[model samples]
Target: MQWIENGDLSFLDNRGMNGFLEYEKAVREIIAKVRVNGDKALLSYTKQFDHVDLETLHADSEHIATAYRDLPGTFIEVIKEAAGNIRSFHEKQKPDSWDVTHADGSRLGQRVTPLDAVGVYVPGGTAAYPSSVLMGAIPALVAGVKRIVLVSPPQKNGEISDGVLAAANEIGIKEIYQVGGAQAIAALAYGTETIKPVDKIVGPGNIYVTAAKKEVFGTVAIDSLAGPSEIVILADDSANPDWLAADLLSQAEHDPLSMAILVTTSKSLGKAVESHIQKQVRSLPRAEIAKKSLDDFGKIILVEDYDDGIKTVNKLAPEHLEIVVTNPEQILPEVRHAGAIFIGAYSSEPVGDYFAGPNHIIPTNRTARYSSPLSVESFVKRSSIIQYSFEAMQNNGRKIAEFARYEGLEAHARAIEKRIQE
Candidate 1:
């Protein structure tokens, strides 16, 4: 890890937005082929890119059932517990249709409705993440989304991972596709012969998949233009070095570009944490990936005081922020932006990632400054409900006409005038 006694935070301004522009040309071609050729194009790309040849793309009930049964009883129990937690959290977020009546008897309110269908993309190949399926699909289920289609890349043997399939079956998601990457996104946005288009797509993927989502956004809603995973730690003398190092490595192992930063008031604690990271990383299975991430994006900034650490962190606007100072809550009020805040040393990043019930599908690459984590809101649509009573219109029609006239909208003014004349 590189240490800076006192460094400018500008270097962290835009982390993951630059390199994907070059992949746009290739991503566009993939989308066009899928749009024109339908399932034929989808199958061809699946075989070519994923190196898996298949006569069929869909995973039927028998296949999913087999996958679910194949898992150990212990693993299944843990998944069930985690699902319960997630469902309970998102159930609270479900909104109801409500209306308010004004003194003039004018009723105006909001009607919240779930989208008809949603597509969830799960990354495949070297890694298999059952947790991701739970994080993305459970909220859609709670939002009452009627159809949930899951797309994942098949392995060299032309089979989806059992873990992913188990998670999907756990949530009662039956429409599963064994295709992934840009073509899968295209098929979801613009329906193929077998696969149907959806209202919105949510999940994480590589650059090609992200670019495809960006291109097809207007055609179908997307959660966000997600980038690499990231986390930032704000620690003081009270923080534990071993725990801090473990937390930082959890995010760093995600990708080579994933960021792990530390802003501390004590210089000695920073050095101790750095030593612990080096020792801990040596034993990790993905040590090579974590090592590259640390060398490229990892940082340790030693600030003069706690106030200085908080000020610098707001500028970073990390996806996950861990406040491990003397009193973590005291610093939370000053934290302006972050996708998720893990308070104190006990509240680690993985707790939220898996069993804690909060969605792990968080905005990355400094987008936490504006965007938010995925939730029930991502799967639902809201509409304004307005019904003006006769008396209310009669009382305000002239004022409404004059305001319309001020805007030079003659038709709008005349419409109000006609209503008033009635």
Candidate 2:
């Protein structure tokens, strides 16, 4: 980890996205083939890319049942607990339809409605993310989405991850397909023979999947263009240097591009954290990846005071933020950006990633400035509700027509004028 003082911090901006342009041609072709060939393209791509031949595309009850039989009871219990937490948090976020009536008898409001269907892409092949299944599916279910579909790549045994299946089963999601990558994304956007099309798609994947999501965004709503994971810790002399080092490594181990940084008022604490990270990186299982991430993106930034630290962290607007100062309450309100905020020493980034009720699928690459963490809101759509009484239209009709004509939209003017009482 490198140490720097609070001067020109523009070097840490991280403006560029992952190598997206490199994959655009490939992704466009994959989407085109899936749209034209449907199930044939999905099956052929599965066999070609995943190197596994599957007899069927859909996962039946037997698949989930086998997962329960094989998985450890303790792991199942933990998954249930995590799922409950995620569900409870999102349920609080559920939106209700509301309307307000004006004095002129005009009713205007928003009618909140869930999408007809949603697709959750869980990455499979090298790793099984049971956690992702819970994060991505539970919110849509809480939002009242009627259909929830799960897609993941099959492994060498021609089966999806048991852990993933177990998570899906926990969430009451039965519609799952054994397919992944850009082709699977296409299938989710446009229906195949085996899989029904979803109105929206949510979850994270490799660069190819990310590229596919970018391509299919207009065809179907997507969660966000997620970038590499990142974290910014605003700490002081109060924060334990050892714990801070371990926390930084949490994001670092995720990928070679993942960024971890410490913004602190105390120079001594920054140095200590940097030293601890060097020592900790050697012992981790993903040492090679963590080492590369730390070498490239990790930093220990020194600030003049608490105000200075907060200002710098706000500009970064990292995906995950932790405030471990002597008085976190004082700093919490000042934070204008960050996908998720962990307030104290106990509230580590991983705690939110796993057990905590908050969704771990947060905006990365400084997107938190405008975007937000994946939540119940991500699964629902809002339709503007308008009901103008004759009296209301009589009052505003001519003005609206005049305004429409100003924009040179005569048809729009006539539509309103037709409703107005002479």
Candidate 3:
């Protein structure tokens, strides 16, 4: 990877969402078909896209049990540990409800309630991520979501990945379905004969799944329009090139479209990291995908100082940010946006991606500028509470009616007038 000086950082501002526009027409048709045909469309699409013929839309107890039996005990133990960490972290994020009473006996507050149901989508093709299951579902469970449904595409043998099923089982999630892509998103948003609509859908998927979520957003809440995974490292001479290179490859291996960028003050470090990346990627199982990603989207920027590097990193707002500077804490305060920040050489990005308890379902494609990682808050809704005493209403009703009248709405004024009269 050749380093560029003061390179154009404008790519971070664009989400690359336009790439999905071509899929929108087909995705919309799928959504419409699912809405009308329900289970039939889901089954047909499963066969068409995933090449799986499903007699049942959901995994039964026997299948789940078999999955558990088939998975290695060590994998089971690790998932349990990760789930515990995720649950503990999200438990701290659970919000409480409280009311404030005014002297006039007017009360106002917010009632934070868990959504009734939630759907988690786990991507499945050749790769099996039990990790996504834990990261996506544990937060909803922490938030007290009653019904947690998990959906993943089936293999050619009409079976969800055993690792995925094992993770879901480990989390005590029973509502597992063998459907995926845009069709799975549609079913999650709109109820089918077999699958009930969920209050929210949270997880990562392919472009078609992302487009489907964008389409059904208002019909049901979605976590975010997650784009390809990405990471940016802000480093100095103190940073280790080998570690930085490994961390960059982590995100690059996710997809060919994923981005791995480095902004640093050390030119030598940049060259060394690029050399390490080339050496390390050759050994990865997904070497082809990682190499393609690096060729297409990978970048290295040489900045004059930490100030310039920090400015560029904030502007890019990469999903996963690593601060491998001399004093990461000092540099951390300046970071305005990023899905998650890893500090120091020891705190590798994969630690948070798997076990450090923060949700790995983070905002990608510069969405870190506004969006946040999935958490308990994503699984709950807040309703405003307002109760005014008769005396308080009598004192304020006329004022409200006057304001409504100024806006030229007679009915709005009359409603306040009626309350005042009473």
Candidate 4:
């Protein structure tokens, strides 16, 4: 990991813009083929990439039921617990349809409506992420989405992971398809013979999946162009190097492209954490990936002071920001950008990722600057409601017509005029 001192913001370029641009042409071509050819394109891509032959693209009810029976009781219990926490957190985020009336007998408010159907893409390759199932599906369920469809690649035996299916079953998601990659995204965006199109798609996936989501965005609503998982540790001298190293390694294990950064005012603390990382990473199962991630994308920046470190963290805008300082609460108010902020050493990133009430599907590659963690709001839409009585229309309709005419929209003005005249 590179160590930087002084104020240089260029190190904040974690997501290489050039790398994404290089793959854009290929991803766009895949999206275009999927859109034009539909199911044919999906089958071809699935066979070529996933090495799985499929006569039917959708998973049958029997397969889903079998998954439930196959999964262990302990795992099912854990899923239930996680689901409960996720549900509780998102329930609070659910916006209410509210209306307010003025004395002029005019009613104006907002109506919150859930999307008709939503598709969630779960990645299935090296790992089966049941946490993702809970994170993505619970929000849609809480938003009152009627149809929740899930799509994931099947193994050589033509079966989804038992844990994934169990999570889906727990959430009451019956419609699941045995598909993956950019092709699955395309199928979700444009309905196929077997798979139906959806109002929105959410979940994290590989670079190709992210690129495909970006390409098919206008055709169907998507959560965000999720990049690699990342975590930034803002530690002080008071932080334990062992705990800091463990937290950083936790995120790095997610992907070889994932980033783990440490910003500290104390040079000794930085070096101590670096040594600790070397020792701790040796025992991890995904140590190879974590090592590569740290070698390539990770950093240990030595800021001049705590304020400079905080400023650097804001500019980086990491997906998961951890404040392993003496007083985490004191510094939390200053953090302007971060998908989720973990305060103190006890509140590790994994806690938020799995058991915590907050959603873990966070914005990556500095997207936390503008984007937010997935919530119930992502599954619902709000429509502005307006009702005007005769008295109210007579009083304000002329002003409305004049404003519309000011914008050179004569038809809009005339429409309002006709309503008032009646």
Give the winner by TM-score: 1 or 4. 1
Models 1 onward score TM values of 0.98, 0.95, 0.97, 0.95
Off by over 4 Å in 3: 13-15, 419-422
- Model 1: CA > 4 A from native: none
Local distance difference test scores for all models: 0.91, 0.91, 0.91, 0.88
Tens-place lDDT per residue, model 1, 23-121, is 999999999999999999988998889888788989756878898899998998889899999999999999889999999999999999999999999
Which stretches in model 2 have alpha-carbon errors above 4 Å? 13-15, 414-422
lDDT of 4 at 87: 92
**Per-residue CA lDDT of candidate 2, range 1-422, in tens?**
77777456776555446479999999999999999999989989999999987778988679789997789999999999999999899889988989999999999999998889999999998788999999999999899888999999998888899999999988898999999999999999998888889999999988899999999999899999887889999999999999999999999998898888989988889888988988998999999999998898888888888888888989899999999989899999999999999999999899999888999899988889999999999988899999989899999999999999999999999999999877
In terms of lDDT, model 1 sits at 0.91
Compose the digit string of candidate 4's lDDT tens values, residues 1-422.
87878666685564744456766788888878877888888888888888877788878778778888888888888888989998998999989999999999999999999999999999996578888889999999999999999999887676777778888988888888888988898889888777879989999998888888887889889999888888999999999999999999999998998989999988999999999999999999999999999998888989887788889999989899999888888788889989999888799889998998899999887888899999999999999999999899999899999999999999999998998865
Give the count of colliding residue pairs in each prediction: 0, 0, 0, 0
Model 1 quality (TM-score): 0.98
Provide the global lDDT of candidate 4 against the true structure: 0.88
Q: Please, what's the RMSD in Å of model 2?
A: 1.7
lDDT of 3 at 128: 81
Error of 1 at 363 (Å): 1.1
RMSD of each: 1.2, 1.7, 1.5, 1.8
lDDT for model 3 = 0.91
Residue 283 CA error for candidate 4 (Å)? 2.5
Candidate 3 worst ten-residue window by lDDT: 6-15
Global fold similarity of model 3 (TM-score): 0.97
Q: Which residues of candidate 4, in runs, are more than 4 Å off?
A: 14-18, 419-422
